[model samples]
Target: MSAVPAMPAVRVAEGPVRIALVGSPNSGKTTLFNALTGSSARVGNYAGVTVERREGVLTGSHGGVRILDLPGTYALDGETPDEHVVHEVLHGAVPGEPIPDALLVVADATTLRRSLALVHEALALGRPALVVLTMIDEVKARHGRLDPLALSRHLGVQVVGVVGHRGVGLDVLRGFLDDARNWRVARVPTGIADAGARFAWVDRVVHEIGADVLAADTRSDKIDRLLLHPVAGVVVFAAVMVLLFQSIFAWAVPAMDAIDTLFALAADGVRATLPESWLVGLLADGVIAGVGSVVIFLPQILILFTFLHLLQDVGYMARAAFVVDRVMGRVGLQGRSFVPLLSCFACAVPGIMATRTIASPRERLATILVAPFMTCSARLPVYTLLIAAFVPATSVGPVGLQGLVMLGLYVLGATVALTAAKILNSTLLRGRVSVFYMELPPYRWPTMRMLVRQVGQSARAFLRRAGTIILAASVVLWVLLHVPQAAPIAGATPAETARANLEASVAGRLGHAIEPVIAPLGFDWKVGVGLVASLAAREVIVSTLAQIYAVSEGESFRGVLEAIQADIDPRTGRPVFTLPVALALMVFFVFALQCTSTIAVMARETGGWRWPAFAFTSMLLLAWLGSFITYRLARFLA
Candidate 1:
């Protein structure tokens, strides 16, 4: 860890004023950040829907200022990881990070009591914090008014009204931050009071502030009634999800094709230019083909995130959580689990990180255990290719029948996870009362900068994963599938002969020996060989299978798919991947915890190998059993 500078460091030249906005959950803190920062930060449903942070540079008279949007929480008692990060930021305890020169605490005007809990906690930390009462429009519309002067006098902090979404009251907030010395800690009552004392202070402040203003309907409440209606809300939710999945297919197809064409052109160019040797073969056939196969899916990945970003910007994520809370709870999950589970829809790493919002250890653990079951973007390419090949595209009513199958696979993963969670909650992870508090934040338009940052981050993360573990594994698989000659006897060309000799190699023999056990599961020795190689990454199975089935016929997308479809056992004269085999493969993929990145994340998040060990063992076991049963059922039915 690096050390924090002795003082706040800024560029010598004048830049934007570095201001940090802090607030309790649903206090409109982010709205204020969006307002002040001009919505420059990307908005998205974070790993946990409960808390999300955004940052942007704000232009000011003095210079450019850096602004941070923090997760909303009631207090800094450090009840959860998100709260704990807040505690650290205020005290300058985060490694190598400077404390903010000014703190802006957004408070909900209507819920003065609930919001003040965070204000008092921030004040106690002796930081340069001010109170910005948000949702004033909502308050006034609801017949609530606050006396800024009295509230400031009582709280000993500067108070300002900020309608963050509309850019209202920001100049006053900025003018206050221009001078940090004016900020001071709130003075406590002369003597300590009972547990209710804090509540009493909250009530007194509201009364002095003239809490009630008008009885008219607030804009937010009116909007909520429509968006949160039980029936209308769920219909809208399903529509949005359907739209997102459809967009991934329809919007991304052209871009994906373009990428594929470009890579194919590059591979052909390289092969033409370079001498026909192992090094060129490695680049053209092994590295380029294997990695490019995955990288081309970036278009689909980007499209998936774009929809997620839009949903978050519009603030319907919280409502989705509320709508799904009943279903989640029935599966022994907290309402808070909705965000993390939804996050797992993208990737399990962030989902595990999002578990920071769950206060109970048991709930967090259960969430982590089931996170990997969520269909992540990594699995999408394999699923897409297989489904496209096997499942015919047709309409089921108004819906694309292929898309419904895709949706079914996602639902399958989620259902298995929820079931697994229930079983675990009753056994290994049972205990403790789970709290389900969260704020349904108001919607805002997503800024361009925020969208770019989020998409960039997601893309970079995927590339990094592919570069490190996947690259190393691919090279090793290349060698295992390529090296060691069986015998150099007859008139076979080197190209034909080299790989055939691999059967005498260590990897091939092992795969051959294991073939009998997996034969019933519809896997050949070559498939067994790919599986062993794919202990490194499940997606690699496709590329490895492509290579294994290619033989001396040469490789192409159509050729590989045809070979896969055409594969048959010499003894049975039956296709290797029968419909049952394909169905079983799908089920196995649905339940298997195959990503090494997810495993490493679990270890880091849980602070040990114990949790990851448990996760790996149980998920793999379940995957095996589920696939075996699926294979048998398919065969019996056939």
Candidate 2:
């Protein structure tokens, strides 16, 4: 072991010091950031590469400190977008952002050697820096003990140990931050020709601080034996996913029913209080039915988010990526693409954003283009509505048939995405495939505080969308379906009058115009209207259907679904929304690129209209074809 070096005395910068929190992914840097600043910035066990940079004020007995949580990067080299963002931020190249006054390089204590290479890169920048060793408990559990003071001496910099999640050693860490004047640049080896030199230097530091913890068979390793086995890993992964989607149905039933009952009560209240006029129609049929239809899915979204957060916190997500690497590689996508694609189940906008972590532009573009094919939370309402209406809630062995259908839809989307990626890699975006590399962090017990925060953030985002875009779309759709009210016939009932009014509305006319194009897929003019309205968001499809039927049938959501089930086609004198038609609608939604937010994100990510336009056109065509085939096949089977 080498002798520890003495730290040179230095003066801390005056005024508020801007410190950039840099670390490798999953190093607990964000956890430390949250602890120091008391911000609820999202934390994930997997590499959260797409999360935007966040800033917060760290206030303590030492006054206020400005802390910028930079994106996690394995190196300062600009190889990936995350690294580039961190690099630019550190260099003050990003406009309106100052160069950091100092660097807080956080390292995973258990994986100290892997983290030190980046720490070395930071030191080369000639900035006053301090090392914060996080996950000290994990290190100790692995029979490792780190003396931060000794390590600081050996590295010629200040060092502190913190268990960010448990809030241990945080006050001491803060006290070190307060004494920023004593912080000094680390004396790392210069002229590192290759990674070998970096590892050698890291080994020396580890030995000097007595942080070379003895290896032992632990719980994670024991679990990984089964979870990482080729056959068992894949089976467990599939089973986990099936249960996740199944829980979306099983767990959310009570919450969904409650939301539905509440909305029904609100509608009944409005009907009783308001006069029989357009105002009443708007409030009962338009606003309540439209918004409530989409809002009811909030429970399922939250549940899905909860499962995702739990899996991430427990460090299963990275293993999932590893398990699927071979399968993904066959489709020209690296294992890293799995995380972003998995994120697509929540929404594609963020998934597309997450492609930034992919090092190769061709691979990233390919991933972005196909990300929307994964069934997002926005599609949940439509899927749930159709499956409930058409698919029987019976058991396929232990699994509910409806749940299987939902899982099938998700699987179908992923399959299509992978197929599309394969095609793109062979043709338009063809390039050499990049090798996937990821570190599997040790699993830890998920904390209640972190889980609640994650669930709350997702719930807030979902509600915000419901309040803004969904609300606005519902109102606009209401006006479209209600205006140009027909002159009343003397003997006509209120329902008849409402139906006539909808038939004469502008929305009806547009729907009629598009009906011919969609007829092959078993959709009528009304369904056509919904497909059009939902271009703003996929969830709007359910709301639009509710609004359309509410005006025409003057019914509740269940009533509307029942009415559709019994609807007679005027020409054929047969039921509309038959099993075939319902299945076709699901297929269409599964393939359609209808969400404007997703399109906008794709456009921004691809840096042009060309690719997004191509995506929209291709997806639209695929949706039409898929729906046509599904309708024909289902009709034949029926």
Candidate 3:
């Protein structure tokens, strides 16, 4: 027999009773949220140990409740925007936001004194606070004792032990949710509210509890013994990164190839069925070809996210930041900058936003300004198309030679970004280096659910950007390259060959006029056309090139590659994209801030266009200079 569902619970003036999970960095607050809400939360340490907020709804055995995973903060008495939000929400200060009815103070059992600082601070507000002792399993195995009941009594709130990842304490926490009266505000003396005084009181509470709390196992120390070794750690880190790149290519290649093949077949079907005409060509080449070209890269992107998701889920990502901290510090960045900087390897927008955790505005802005120098996954389509066509995969010892080149490009982008950040720090956005401090979460096996969710979220984000920006850009590029139809010459190919007539169109004429400016850069009129086309979106460079070379036909990668390889400059009779030019092109992409979305986001986040404008102009200058040097040097070397 079906059981009747519980009736709705009492609603506050704010609509629903809102509970926020608050804690110190790496206190497993998000993990608890995932457990309570059955949410597939994407957990990662943001900008070292500073926390970022996330929210989910929990409606299970307990009545429905909205759960906010507030950023893990050390204390709530700050003017920092994140901390301020927490304070305002608790005091009903933020307009249009719900005032939290209950505060679930997640505390790490292994480090009770440090964890309790926030709880003690929260209690001062006289709000209903419940202490959720997190990581009880780790605490018991390593620390040797924890008296949750005693700790609760001392703090004047109900405390529950939770092994969040393993799904413990949900029932206990939920039970307390039904009876708000059990919680009370503790009034502590102002003298005892000093940092040292508060810590002293917390220490006394643990001491009085005797030896029931188990200590946290020194697993981190043991693991760090090898993973943190200077030479070995760097070696292992490099090996891990190489494997990630390989996995991205190997695991996703088949699906990407299948996507390409399906689209190619679809184009063929359209060509065979419809009579040769401009409308048929636009439908097949302009619409189908343009969208499919971008979509084909999604599988590889999803694959990359899967590996990143696992690393983050298993808690090695924090260590990765620690290991890279020294290198990052040279550029006025913290160890926490590692995840976001590394994330920029996938896309700059997320990487830029990820810098929010950096407390220092100058450091964060510098990080943001230089972030686009890191090659994003969007560049992959361009790189793969070019590299496979141009760079040979000769045997390099035991590794795939092409893979090493791909790895070099990635490393090159990072190196450039780091150097750029250092330059920006010293010249434009100088600031004091932020000291690195972050808690390493206990290592755990990644759940499939977590990996799938993270990967899906990343892929969805990538596709969404492509759909909005790239999609619109592609349509505009297609029209620019195709419309304002060039009047057919008396004896030129028929008007049906619209592509041949494109050279006389508005876009083509503009490309011709600007051709001389970039000619020394080894760009011909068609390549200039591509550069213009790319202003809409970078990947469109591939499709534009495809159209330029296959104008008589449509979009074909092989056809474009062959044309590029064979084409001679009309003025110099030299190859248009010589090795020098290709290298220069790669260098330009490394430094250029090409995405409009990144600029808009930077403007909004910084609350003005000044930063974005500065970023754009500075990056464009760097890109031009870098590309020029690369071209001239490569030519001189040859």
TM values, all candidates: 0.77, 0.81, 0.83
Candidate 2 lDDT over residue span 1-638, tens digit each: 25745332223354677788989878899878877887434332112233366777786634447788988888887565567778888888877777888899999887887888888888878788998989888777778788888887877888888899999989987877766545787787678877788889888888877878757637889999999988899899899877875787688889988998999799989999887877887888677866786678777767777887788789897888788778888998887687678767767765675576565556788899999899987788788888888898899899999999998998999999999999999998765434446777777789999889767766775576567666676677778877787788798766666667767787778889999999999999989888877776787666566555653433545766676777788899888888889899999999999886677667666766788899999999999999999999998998
Cα lDDT tens digits, model 1, 1-638, are 36865443445223444566778766777657766656356533223323344677664633356777876667766566667677777777766546776787788876786677667666665666788998787666566667777788887888898777666788888777666544776664533244377667766766666773456455557778887888887888678766765676578779878987887777788989988876776676567666665576677667666666666667776677678778878878876687677767656665676676565566777898899998876677667766766666889999997798788889999888899889988988665445567667655666776677556766776676656655555566666665664777588765446546556656677679889877777777876776665555677667666656644434534655677788888988977776677777777788878776678667756766788898888887887788899889978988
> Candidate 1 overall Cα lDDT vs. reference?
0.70
* Candidate with the greatest lDDT versus the true structure: 2
Kindly report the root-mean-square deviation of model 3 from the true structure over all alpha carbons.
6.2
lDDT of 3 at 516: 82
**Candidate number with the higher TM-score (1 or 3):** 3
Candidate 2 runs further than 4 Å off: 1-15, 40-51, 59-63, 179-182, 189-194, 274-288, 334-414, 427-435, 519-524, 536-586, 595-614, 628-638
Sort by TM-score, top down from the best: 3, 2, 1
| Ten-residue stretch with the least lDDT total in model 2 | 42-51
**lDDT per residue as tens, model 3, 467-573:** 77656655666677777776565655543344565676667777888888776766668877777776655676776676566534544567777877887778777
